[model samples]
Target: MAQQGPTAPVPVPKAGSTPPVSKPVREGIDLVVNDKLYRHTGDKTMPLLWYLRDELRLTGAKYGCDQGDCGFCTVLVEGKAVASCTTKMEKLAGKRVTTVEGLADGQGKLHPVQQAWIDEDATMCGYCQPGQLMAAVDLLSRQKNPSDADIDKIGNLCRCGSYGRIRKAIKRAAATMKDAKA
Candidate 1:
């Protein structure tokens, strides 16, 4: 049997030589979603929409119009609607993020806005409805009696041309919420 020679000593780079490349350090963030605390660790520069959809599996926030023109990725950050497609994770630390999934009560009860959306049948292809509903919820919270211009200011484009239905739904939701408060 041939004798195997001792393995040559592994080459070690001198102290001044280039150090081995290390993996990029991951960052951690604390996010409150649907009144729940969630810890996330990953690239801080990633889009919030991607983080919500890919990591947390909250797929309600769509990825349409990643350029920020369309409101397909709309989400409520601390009760204000923001486009998640361009929102970086670093900007959302310790912030409350509300997607379509978070709009309802914890008991799986539909929010008045969601109920009105269903009643009004505001969805067409339904691709943009999540963002539309998110934006509507934020808007109604501030403006219980929103004007046509106010509805237009939501800036959520419906390629399926459900704008009329969306406006009606917002009005219906406002009425329902107002009635509930009374």
Candidate 2:
């Protein structure tokens, strides 16, 4: 016969104590993107960038640094610029998300920021323009006449070193929007 060893005692429920009940599992998340409603039932932890690019096929928000440091994945969540790479599906329930594709009007009119970018030749590679445009949209929505410091706070990087042109484009867009309002 083999030698027996001491076994640890198993936890037993006390008298009148009931088993712990598990939390109810979440069914899904619902959100609106580009004015269209979306019901997401997959992993709740999925990043908004992946949902937009992979599931929705809205690839305007580019994947730069997945760490959320670069603003390349920036998008408008409730009209506020957010880093989509770090925003999770679980947090966007019933929220409105807007990608660069949604910036154009139904009549095919380009957004002021987009037109300004073209007019100013603000892009070199054009990889970071989507994020820059979204950020600029949010900024302009808040600040009618943004100064150099305000434009600099857009926080999107252009590897093409088009900062000067980008600043000019934002200024142009701001002016155009102001004119449209008046």
Candidate 3:
């Protein structure tokens, strides 16, 4: 062993002994998705999209640009629209996550936004519709009467270029939701 300097390294903790205090210990994580609790024990850095699609089978959040540029994996994390592709699972521990599948009522009644989509036939390929619906749901929750600028802020890109129909559906859904509320 080398000679110990005046400023030596801290000794390792003995067996069963607690180590020096530092940052919190990393451990298992619990995530709430669509009112369901999921326990994660592997790498905490896994992106939420993989967990939702691969593990939970909630595949509505499509796999698009995985770098957060594409909104195909958009979902609501605590009522805020988030890009699930780049959202780390560690950050979602104990957070409420709502996907497109969870937007409907427990009685199987579709949300007004979903109904609007069907009525307007806004889906073409239907791949990006899930993300669009999620974004629109979040938007409508915040603004009952969303303007064109509000729609633009959703940032969800539809490859089918169905922006016109989507805009119309949003308006229709807003009206229906308002009527239901009253």
Candidate 4:
């Protein structure tokens, strides 16, 4: 073994030392939910539904389909109806979100749409009612005295086939809201 070359020393791990685990860097995200300001510093990829249900404990918006097609997780974001399941937290900065629980007044007076839902007996299983009500609220906010075609555009599905009743309730709620404004 003539002329041995110098070998680089290998770094050895210390005993009882654990490797550092990397956590996702959380950024401050701000939004208003149901007239309350919320500041979240968690995974930015989390959907609004998870923030509402798991973090905020506002469960009125049911989890029917994780995909946006179902409309079961519909909520109002910045006064527009949106599928909460598909709305990521990163997109909600400085936005206002309204859930089904926010439909009632501070004095416990039911929103016209909620009352109409009850008066028209629109619920069969009641699982889809929250999403339906939120969609109706957003629709009525934009369109006054919506036509049958417009009502059909709400797009929230009821497994119980309560379309007729839902339509009637929307009409009634629109009338009630209009009268209240006048």
Residues 108-163, candidate 2: write the lDDT tens digits. 89999999999999989999999999999999999999998998877788889899
**Candidate 3 accuracy as TM-score:** 0.83
lDDT of 1 by residue, 1-182 (tens): 56433222223344477435487634567677766666566678989898888777889999887988799999999999999999998998878888999888888899998999999999889999999999999999899999889999989999999899999999999999999999
The candidate maximizing TM-score is 2
Better of 1 and 2 by lDDT: 2
> How well does each candidate superpose onto the true structure, as a TM-score?
0.83, 0.85, 0.83, 0.84
Question: Per-model C-alpha lDDT, please?
Answer: 0.85, 0.87, 0.84, 0.86
Task: Give me the displacement of residue 135 in model 3, in angstroms.
Answer: 0.4
Show the colliding residue pairs in model 1: none
Residue 138 alpha-carbon offset, candidate 4, angstroms: 0.8
How many collisions between residues are there in candidate 3? 0
- Model 4 spans with C-alpha error above 4 angstroms: 1-26
lDDT of 3 by residue, 25-107 (tens): 44667666777655666668989898887777788999988898879999999998999999998898768899999999979
In model 1, state the lDDT of residue 47.
94
Model 2: worst 10 consecutive residues (lDDT sum): 3-12
Clash count of each predicted structure = 0, 0, 0, 0
Give candidate 2's whole-model lDDT.
0.87
